[model samples]
Target: MATAAVFLDRDGVINKDKGYVSQIDDFEFIDGSIEAMQLLKAHGYLLVVITNQSGIARGYYTEEEFMTLTEWMDWSLADRGVDLDGIYYCPHHPGKGIGDYKQDCLCRKPNTGMLDSAGKELDIDFANSYLVGDKLSDIQAGQKLQLKANYLVSTGKVLCEKGAEAADGVFTDLLSVAKAIVNG
Candidate 1:
């Protein structure tokens, strides 16, 4: 009787991907994103955020900044009656990262480390879960874990047409993805 979750990518999926948006002013939730999250939450879906934070490794921002932003984002979501179960991010880049972040890490997307961790802590049934992201790496990660569903949204780096080819389904944005998950 394990729980299942909806893994989400932060950038583009949550907010606009305006390039390393570490500032509060730059953070903007996509249209209907909050309502979508609320719907998912109401349906007993555990919301988990899995993101690749190369900005920290690239020296564009610090982990503390990232944490601050997460706090704000979480608070905002809570305001809209959406509560997230957990959030995981990888600061490693393997090539473009600086110092310790330059090396490969298991928590990075395209790998199942974060999902594995969540499975352990949240009792997530990977085969019964879903992942929504705007990149191939996100789809790759979901496939790696053999998740029940993988959704690619066209609101980010990967367009819907392109992501649709690789994902279980393509969505216009997080809101659409949310609706599909709740009502599908």
Candidate 2:
């Protein structure tokens, strides 16, 4: 039996999606995000982050700057007693990207590269894992990987629309997702 995990999409799901957020001041953690992570952690689920950061590929920011901001974010979450197990990001875009980043990458969302890597490296049971994200691509990624559930959050770019049928479940915010995960 492999360990289970909760894969999270960083921008929009954990933090407010403020377009290529590269600074500590610009990184705003969404309400209840920390608590939700805490809940997952308490339940013995490894907390992992799989995100697409095309901003780096677009030259909006550097990888070093993204790491700086990520360090601050990790500190913030640690202060709240929620330690993330790992974070994986793909800085690639098929278009509008520079040089090495111009190619399509498997680690990007809608692909299971990150999840597969995390599963292999961290011993995660893909069939027992769950994913929470704000985009249809996120759901597709989890579905393709056969995760236990996928919760599409209506907090940022992927707002909930009537008759927009895609995800296994939908929530208004990360807090709502947490409630469903914990209560069920």
Candidate 3:
């Protein structure tokens, strides 16, 4: 009775990582990402965005700014006929955080905090879920949760060392992964 999900990393995977994007003007979707998402939806996969918004912790941006941008993105996607199931973000960084945000938390990627929370709340089947990330921590997070597959994308920061080993496969972008998912 559990539904399958596609865990997505915000920066590099969903939107262009324009250096801690906190403003709507800075947020840009990767080409074809919206179309790919439509395909995923048609195939019946719940879409969840799990991101690390360390800018909030580092005092680079306020929580309100982040929320505003998030709302814009979600609304824009909705206009394109794609509605995300859940959007979860961790505003923490152990070293760089200024105040209460400074802590080593399990919600960060490579840990399964965000993923586990979404699964419990959204009825996701972890073993059947898939993850698409550009960083090694993203792949590690899905691996720790033992998802069906984890893909490393060429966009974003593109962690190459340990991430390659952790990833189930590497792709040019999210659209290619979408095609593979729809066809596979």
TM-score on alpha carbons, each prediction: 0.96, 0.95, 0.98
Return the TM-score for candidate 1, rounded to 2 decimals.
0.96
Top TM-score prediction, candidate number = 3
Candidate order by TM-score, decreasing, is: 3, 1, 2
Q: Where does candidate 1 stray beyond 4 Å?
A: 160-162
Query: Higher lDDT: candidate 1 or 2?
Result: 1
Between candidates 1 and 3, the TM-score winner: 3
| lDDT tens per residue, model 1, 1-184 | 7987899999988899999988899999988778878888888989999999999999999999999999999999998898999998888889999999898889888988888888888999888799999988899899998999999888888474555688999888988988888777
Q: Rate the local accuracy (lDDT) of all candidates.
A: 0.89, 0.87, 0.92
**Tens digit per residue, CA lDDT, model 3, 35-122:** 9899999999999999999999999999999999999999999999999999999999989998899999999887889999999999
lDDT of 3: 0.92
Candidate 2 per-residue C-alpha lDDT over 1-184 given as tens digits, one digit per residue, 9 for 90 to 100:
6889999999999999999999998988898888889888888889999999999999999999999999899888999999988889999988988999888889888998999899988999888889999988888899999899988887778455531366778888887887787788
Candidate 1 colliding pairs: none
**C-alpha RMSD by candidate, in order:** 1.3, 1.5, 0.8
**Model 2 scores what on Cα lDDT?**
0.87
